[model samples]
Target: MSEHKPYTYVTASIHEGVTRFDVSFCTSEMSAKAFGGDGERPFLTLSSTEAHMTVTTTGGGPVTEQDVTLAREIFTASARYLANCERLHAEQPVNPTDQTTPSGEVAA
Candidate 1:
């Protein structure tokens, strides 16, 4: 039986309310050889903003093109959820007067 290599690496980041994600999954050199010289080399990256999301992926073979449809779909879904949470948080009202304490002292 041929052994399959496990895909590794997934990263996510949130900056300035924007979310970005990257995922890389592919067989190692040894596994590639075991699987008859490379079996579906997958690399995916996704980025999302308040307005939209983008994704890109790479498949097997040295010159193979990346598949980004799945990544984009995932990113869009995540962005929607995050945006909803942000909107809910923003809708909450905070009283400015509550900033000061009763003892004639300002609250930091």
Candidate 2:
């Protein structure tokens, strides 16, 4: 509930991909490597080339090990949960969005 406790989150939609991150309560901008949105994988993964963390918070360098660790844990856990949900979803049969006819056309 603190006005300046430390940070916040950003959900951005990129063409052909997605970018999600945590930003400290700063007037400037920042970026970070996040997981849980890679379409190829049911979940997400982070690595040196796969992802990165960028901070442009006007003199906000030296990101701590704890910060990166925390973000990794959070995103990984989320991805795991999503994978489980997708598994469950796949078990169900696909339902027709609307009634169909023998001609493979929508029925009135």
Best of the candidates, lDDT: 1
Segments in model 1 whose C-alpha atoms lie over 4 Å from true places: 1-67, 93-108
Per-residue CA lDDT of model 1 for 1-108, tens digit only, reads 255655556688999999998655442221111112255444443322221222223434443222445546766986997799676545433445455444445555
The sequence of per-residue lDDT tens digits that candidate 2 reaches over residues 11-95 is 4555556655542233223333433334321222232322333422224444456656765787798699779978655553344
Superposition TM-score, candidate 1 onto the true structure: 0.27
The stretch of ten residues in a row with the least summed lDDT in candidate 2 is 40-49
Cα RMSD of predicted structure 2? 16.3
Q: Tell me the TM-score of each prediction against the true structure.
A: 0.27, 0.31
lDDT of 2 at 79: 96
**Candidate 2 C-alpha error for residue 59, in Å:** 10
Candidate 2 runs further than 4 Å off: 1-61, 96-108
